[model samples]
Target: MQILLVGAGLSGAVIGRKLAEAGHSCRIIDARSHIGGNCHTERDADTGVMMHVYGPHIFHTDDQEVWNYVNGFAEFLPFQNRVKSTTQGAVYSLPINLLTINQFFGKTMRPDEARDFIAGQADRTIEDPQNFEEQALRFVGRDLYEAFFKGYTEKQWGCAPTELPASILKRLPVRFNYDDNYFFHRFQGMPKDGYTPMIAAIMDHPNITVQLDTPYSADMTATVDHVFWSGPLDGFFGYDLGRLGYRTLDFERFTHDGDYQGCAVMNYGDRDVPWTRITEHKHFSPWEIHDGSVCYREYSRAAGPQDIPYYPIRLVKEKALLADYIARARATEGVTFVGRLGTYRYLDMDVTIREAMDTADAFLNCARRGTAPPAFVTSPD
Candidate 1:
């Protein structure tokens, strides 16, 4: 079978590799002039730093299979994302750990004491929090919420915390212990050479052909047996229903002779700060040393048609339109929508790879049985 993959990112690369190994011919194409999508990285000729072109992508996952799958392509270097935040004229540890709790209130409380103290600080009046603001206030009370979350949440989502859903805040945890590691995954690392090489290695099979800077045309599908689309779900339908809301980021890059922020990521919790976070690219590859540093001050805003869509805003308005697109995709034949953009959801790199592998498995099984493959392996909802 001849397969047409609509995006040259991890989703297309993984699925294409799997199908190609099974004696299927795969042609992968991307609108951008490169592979790896947002995970694209390049070396800074001046600073000799591996600059995360779009943004920082740290590979962290509990799935051992996914971990092994990526390591097969590129050397994996140990990297734990320890995030920091600045607000109210002081720098503090993120995820609200014991240190942050004690320092913010100026109390030297132990783990158990801190936990109890935070519990007392919480607003017990709101038993069931409805929105982001209520949830944060109920969990950490006014002071901590305002200092660490309120302003940052408002800036990141481009709206007041009161308007955002509670589930967004639920993803973050206030730890009683001093474990400042951002993710709780068993396996966490960065690609030694960067994500582009890993993705290029994945698509290097003899049966696979890659075309960069190739926009998806309706006529291309006529030549292929099946289509795996990793582009935006609304885009495939010409966005007739309406465009799904997305948050795009604007990165302001600058170079520093020495260490800039002394960390990989430094988030600004004060809404008045304007930018959400500053990422030091040199810190991302601590294994390699360079005198100069490259960093990006990230600013988030509502995505325009011309902007590169980053975070999917699945607010009430977008959900209704997403349902329509999902239904239309199901009715369409010979096409499978895969990956983050295809489903219009914010997906981590690990989840994206896992789903792509599973999608390939399902496709191969269906082919053997002479049956139609699913339009979506995982439900968007």
Candidate 2:
């Protein structure tokens, strides 16, 4: 079978590799000059730091199989994402941990005491929260919500928390313990060399052909048995219904003589701060030391047609448009929508890879059974 894998990110690379290994001819095309999509990384020539060109992407996953599969391509160094945030001229650990709670309130309360105190602070009137603001107020109370989440969420998504869905705040855990680790995952690390190399290795199979700087068009679908699209779902249909809401990032890069921020990520939770976070590239790979450092001050805004879409703002309107796209996609033949953009959801790296592997397996199984593969291995809705 001749398979056309669109977008040479992890989703395309993994699926392409799997199909090629199964004796199918796979051609992976990416609009960018490189692979790895948003996870693309490169060594800073001036500072010798492995720069996450897009932003910081720490690979943390509870799935051991996905971890091992990625490790097969490149060595993953042990890395914990200890995130910090600044607000009102004070620095605090993220996820609103015990330390942050204690520091913010200037109280030496234990975990149980903190939990009880926060419970008291939490608004009991709202039994069932409908939006992000209500969820935050119910979960962590007014002070913590305003300090840690409100401004940050507004800047990140470019909208008031009240307008956003509760599901967004539900993803972030509010810890009563002193554990400052951002993610609660079994496996957490970054590729030793970089994501580009790892993705390159994934697509290096004998039966796979990679075409960088090549955009896959709907016309190209005629030449392949199947198409695995990792690009935007609305883009596949030329956004006939309407453009889905997405937030894109802009990085203002600069060089420093030595340590900058002294951490991999430092977010500015205060609305006064223009940029969302400042990332020091050297700190991401603590194994290597450099005399100078490269850093980026990231700014977030609504994604334009030319901009690379980062976070999918699946509000009510976008969801309606997405439903229309999904219906059109399902009715169409010879194409399987996979990954974050295809599914139009904010997905972590592990979920993307796991879904890609499952999609590949499903396609292979369908091929063996002489049946048509489903339009979606995982439903967008």
Candidate 3:
């Protein structure tokens, strides 16, 4: 089997590896000069600290299988993601935890009392929440929502909370305990080296040939036996149904002598504040010692024609457009769409890898059975 993988991101790299191991000849191509997509990391020339070229991607997952798979490539150091929010002109912890609630209200309340208090603050009248605003009001009340989430959400999504879906707010952790571990994942850590080297190792295979400057297209539509596209789903069809909405980031880089923000990630929760968050790359891998630190103030905006697509804003309107692409992709032959862009969803690094693994497994199975692989491994709709 001859496979041509577009977009040399984690999805493309992982799937390419699997296919090559399964005795397929795969050639992975990426539009960017380098591979690893958004997860690309490199050592800072000035400080020598590992830098996230796109944004901060902390590897945290509950799946032992995913953890083990990544560990096979690079050693991971135990790291807990402790996030802070700068809002109402003050610093506070996130996830509405006990310490955060007590600090915000200037009261020393117990766990049960804080939980009950927050519940009381929530909008009891909202029997059925519609948008992000109403959902947050129903879950954590107006005060917390406004101070911590409202402005940040607006900036991040480029829309008012009322215009967004409630499901997003549901994934956010809201805890009564004092615990401040940002994610509920069982395994939480940073790659000992960096993501770039790890991904490079993955792409270094006998049968896999990576073409960095080349982009996949209809020109070779008949050349390869199958195409594993990890680029934007809309990009694949040339946005015939209209461009899928995406929120892209703008990073304002700065170098400070020591401890710029004093944290890995700081959420700026004021509409007045332009940037959504500031990430101190040094803190991401605290195992590394550096005298000076580099930081990125992240600004989110609607993705432009040339901007790198980050988060998929799959709203109702975009969902309808995606449905058209889905239909078109299904009708198309010899293509298996995988990864964040293919599925048109915002996914963590681990989820992206897991999906690619599943895709390769299923595709291989179908091939062995002399059948066609499905248009998608995961569907947003």
Which has the greatest TM-score? 1
With a 3 Å backbone cut-off (N, CA, C), the pairs that clash in candidate 2 are: none
lDDT tens digits, residues 88-107, model 3? Answer: 98999976689999999898
Better of 1 and 3 by lDDT: 1
Local accuracy of candidate 2 as per-residue lDDT tens digits, 309-343: 99998898988888899999999999999999999
**Model 2, CA-based lDDT:** 0.92
Give lDDT: candidate 1, residue 329: 98
Residue 167 CA displacement from its true place in model 2, Å: 1.7
Q: Model 1: how far is 305 from its true place, Å?
A: 0.5
Clashes of 2: 0
**Model 1, which residues run further than 4 Å from truth?**
none
lDDT of 3 at 298: 96
Best by lDDT: 1
Model 3 Cα shift for residue 136 (angstroms): 0.9
Q: Candidate 3 — which residues are off by over 4 angstroms?
A: 171-173
